[model samples]
Target: MAASVQRLQKCAVSPTGKHTASVIFLHGSGDTGQGLRAWVRDVITPELAFSHIRVIYPTAPARPYTPMRGALSTVWFDRLKISQDCPEHLESLDSMCSTLGAVIEEELKAGVPKHRMIIGGFSMGGAMALHLACRYHPDVAGVYALSSFLNKDSIAFQAVEQRVAAGQSVPELFQCHGTKDDLVLHQWGEETWSVLRKAGMAATFHSIPGLYHQLSRPEMELLRSWILAKLPPDGP
Candidate 1:
């Protein structure tokens, strides 16, 4: 384990004695890690055995997001001045990449192999997860992006394309979006899914019709199962 990993004061749940896998989840803008914890407690069922795995709900650093005119927000990256589509602030995207990178690295140093770790998030956090999966942590088991689109102009996306061209492994991706999502239009998610799939990533996308910008029951179940599917058989 990395001796440098301490003071990771976020909402987390771990098996009482031992754990072999890790899941880091990022919350949407303006929402704290506690929000994700609530979802676990209130919505998630025990059948998933998530309690046996290490789950982390990391809160984003408070910063002035550019699209939000540098207003302080708990956001992974800055957005567009108007819509939730492409053309995210490049600088902010880099910062988010770095932040997520550190988290993945910490888990790696803690003896979790790249294939045993999963990174994901909701909304803006989900967007950041997709960026990291394509760019930073290609070896990660999979990525779960809920109602989040890809970051436009991501250097990681370009790099991953090059790697894939060289026949490298691409991270498995699971994405779902609400068709009625106005915050981040479902069309954008669909388009991103197509781009990634065509690029050779083992990707899946689901469109929840008539749903808004929120987590539905089916989506939650899908996320839980997706994580289980990506990892190796559980360890004792």
Candidate 2:
């Protein structure tokens, strides 16, 4: 048997024929962007039917996972062991942030306003989404993190404090996690929310009972509503 090859790709959906707001979907570790397309199209679009928006899903580069049986798959960063936080992880964080920033810039040039852009992802991608939204100085509309862990708590806290000192208003955040999620756990989400709240950031945290590491249909519905709420109406 031959090793499977992976590739990075992008998909866009614009139902009203023109783009008004946009949502960038980042997939979880070991998964391709294509995995989340049907979910978004089938679940999110109908809920926000009135708004004409574009959804972008981008795949990450494939790499070897040393922590998981030397598995070759796509990940925003190399895997970290359970309950261990490493400062060295910041390097991968910076790389993903840079890539995501470039994608946002491209969308802006194509006509999406900074205030109408929503950055979101699942698992590792979710962590990257939240990290970038907090550090990136653009007028990001919102951020959604699903079943993800925050990397480098000290650095993230410091960044929040610095932003507050500099008189910057943090973007709104929606964080959801399964109470039974062993991979990241609910406590991680609570801690992240605590830090955000202490810094006066607009944040909402939800714990889905009995859910695991995956998203549920109702959760997707909630996300759709949350995204639309952040976007302005089609007309003034």
Candidate 3:
């Protein structure tokens, strides 16, 4: 197993010199916060260009991943497999949600309102974001997931159901998946969206034609627009 990063490699960006909103983005399995930060700097930051928006990239702790035959990886949680048909690893998921919840709690302590925060990520990270937005921090402004999916019986769905029954609002969801994605199939993404809708959350799905299981500039641009719409700058 490779050595793990003990500290989070947080890439904080506030373009306008003040932070009125935050976007916490996580990277895929086997990747680090530093890797995601580089991509955000090269792709998302340039397009987002919002001064009040502070983008944070957090790395997951290294752990033995079940899907990878117990090999160590920086994944939010363990999984039997990447397929939606596989049962979730609730114990690992619980721990990670608590870990990420602390991260959001820190933002709250810093005076950033929960409604002004957006949680998102790519691949496994995206799946974790969905779990957070629905199960742990449903009060967040929004959530965006790229090339991700959730099982039909995810804890997130149960949380959404309870929240809706209590007349509580849930964060809106924005999901992007490439139609040509073979790793996390497009059908799985669509099924996840359907489940979310049935669970009483407002969601949108974007299909990238001819694309694969990777990020694209157009996807980031669309995400920029969605983020702006969700938490627009306070004033001129």
lDDT of each: 0.75, 0.74, 0.85
Candidate 3 lDDT over 80-129, as tens digits, reads 98777778999899888877877787788888999999999998999999
- Model 3: ten consecutive residues of lowest lDDT: 1-10
Top candidate (lDDT): 3
As a whole number from 0 to 100, the lDDT of residue 9 in candidate 1 is 38
**True-structure Cα RMSD, model 2:** 4.9
Any residue pairs clashing in model 1, and if so which? none
- The positional error of residue 84 in candidate 3, measured at the CA in angstroms, is 1.0
Pick by TM-score: which candidate is best?
Answer: 3
Task: Give me the runs in candidate 1 sitting further than 4 Å from their true place.
Answer: 1-9, 46-51, 82-86, 151-156
- Model 1: per-residue Cα lDDT over 1-236, one tens digit each: 23432333377777554677888888888888887778656755652355456888888777787667878987777766535345667777776677667777778788888888888888887877887777778888888888877644456567678889998997888999998888446876777777778778888998887879887777888888888777645742
Residue 32 in candidate 1 has what lDDT? Answer: 84
Residue by residue across 51-104, what tens digits does model 2's lDDT show?
467777888887666578668878877646544365536766676677777778
Residue 41 in candidate 3, Cα distance off native in Å: 3.5
- Give per-model TM-scores: 0.86, 0.86, 0.92
Segments of candidate 3 deviating more than 4 angstroms: 1-7, 44-49
